[model samples]
Target: MGTTAYERVLSVAVAALHERDPEQLWPLLAADLPALCGGDALIYKLDNWNESEGTLGLSPGVTAEFTALGDEDMGLLRAGYPLAAHYASGPDRAPVTARRVAGRSWSQSRTAQLLDDLLDVDHVLGIPLPRSTTPVTGCMVYRSGRDFTDDELRLAEQLQPLLTAVEQQRQLLRRLDTPSQEAADVALTPRETTVLLLLGDALTALSIGRRLGISERTVHKHIANIYRKLGTHDRVSTVLHAQRLGLVPTASAARP
Candidate 1:
C-alpha cells in the first residue's frame, strides 16, 4: 500500500522541512497541501503575527491574483484583518484552530469583505509558528468554499513546527550571512537602529514612536533618513536591507 495517503504527506513534509529555500518549498507545499488538507491553499510567511511586515511569497502556480493587493489594498486588509486578535484569543500551540467562520463571518466585516472580494476566499486556516518564543511568524491557508475539516486542521497543527524550524533556521542563516559591521556602514544612529528593528517587528510609526518615547513625526524623520541612507523605498525593502546588514532581530534576541 506504500505508506497510505496521510503517511505519505507527513513523509514529504518532514523530508522537505529543511529545504531552506522558499522557492523550492512553496511550490512543493502548494502542490501537496490540497491533497493533504483538501482545499486550495496559499502560504504566507510573515514577520510577525501582527500582519505588518513580510512578503506574501508563493510558488509559480499559486494565487497570482493576489498580486492585485497594492499598498493601499493590503494596508486596509492587514489593518482590518483579525489575525492579531486571533493570536490573542487562541492557544499558542493550537495552530490549526479556525478563526474566520465561513463567508458569513466575513460578510459583515469590511476587512473580510475586502479580502474576500479580492481573493474569493471564505475560510481561513492559520498555522501558528512557535519556533520563536513570542510566537509571531507562521503560515495561513485560505479557501473559497468549504472550511477545512477538523482532521485536516489537526494535520496542519502537526506540520506547523516542521515548517517553523525551517524558517527559524533560515533567519539564523540570514543573520549569520549579514555582517554586523555592515549595519554600521549605513551609519544609522542608535535611535535609528531602534526604529529599524521595531520596524522589522511590524510596528507602525505610531507604535514605534510610542515605544521609543518619541513623537510620530520625529519617528518618520528617522525612517526617512534610514531610507535615504539605505536607498530603499518601502517598509519591506527597508527591513530586507536591514536584515541583509544584520540589523533584523535574531531568534535569541526576539524571544521574550
Candidate 2:
C-alpha cells in the first residue's frame, strides 16, 4: 500500500483499539476495510458454520446483497465456502484467497458460483483473525473481477496483529459489561472498573489517564472511588481485593 492508504488504515486501526463497545468493532471494520483493501465489499464473521449461532456484519455497500439472500442461501453462505473448511482442518491461518484455494476448479465450484450469484462477487479473500479454529472468526473481502494481490495478502498479514489487539480489547470490554456477583457487590461504574483493571496491570495514574484519554486528576478520582468501593488503601490492596472478589482476572488467569 502507498503511504496515504497505509495512513488511512492505520487511523482506522487506532480508532478501533480505542473503541470501548465490543459490538461496534465489526461495523467499524466492515465500513472501511473494503476500500482500504481494494475490494468491493466485505463481511466480518464471528462464527460461520451454524445458521442460528454465528454473527455476520456486512459492509454498508454489501448490506443489500446480503439481505436479498433467502434462508437456504444464507445457510449455504454460513458454510464458509472453501476457506473455512481449509482453515478448520489445518494450522495455516494466514490470509488466503478462494481462487488460490480452489485453483483451476474455482469457476466450477458450487461455493464460488453461490457467492457470485448471491453477493455478485466473483472472488473472495479470507483474512482470519487470531481466534479459535472452530466457528471461523474473521473478515472476508470480495471483489468481482480478480483475486486479491500478493501485496494485499501481505497487508492482511501485517494487519493481523493489530486486529488481534482490538479483538482482545473488545473481549475485555465485554467482560466489564457482563453482570457478575462480584461486580454487583462492588458496584463500580464501568469506567472505574476499567481503571481498576489497569491498576491491576500496575499502571501509574498518569498512564491510566493517558490510556483512557482523561486527565491524571480524573484518573486519581476514579482510583479513589475504586479504593473506597473495594475497601482498600493502596493500589496493591485494591487490586488484590478486586481479584479476590472476581472483579478482574487474577494474574495467573490472565491470557497471554
User: Against the true structure, whose lDDT is highest?
Assistant: 2
lDDT of 2 by residue, 1-256 (tens): 6898789888987778656577887788888888777788887777655555566778886677777777777766676777888888877889999889888787787767887887788988888875557766888888888788999888887777666655655666665435477667777865677788888888899988766656999989999998888789999888888877778878876444
TM-score: model 1 vs. ground truth: 0.55
Q: How many Å off is the CA of 190 in candidate 1?
A: 37
C-alpha displacement of 6 in model 2, angstroms? 2.3
Q: What digit string (tens of lDDT, one per residue) describes model 1 on residues 52-162?
A: 655665533556766767776666544325554556555564655244432355557666566577667766676666544444556667677777777777777766655
Residue 134 in candidate 1 has what lDDT?
48
lDDT of candidates 1 onward, in order: 0.62, 0.77
TM-score of candidate 2 to 2 decimals: 0.72
Error of 2 at 29 (Å): 0.9
- For each candidate in turn, give its C-alpha RMSD to the true structure in angstroms: 14.4, 6.7
Which window of 10 residues has the lowest lDDT sum in candidate 2? 170-179
List candidate 1 stretches off by more than 4 Å: 1-3, 14-23, 76-80, 89-91, 96-104, 132-135, 172-256
Model 2, residue pairs in steric clash: none
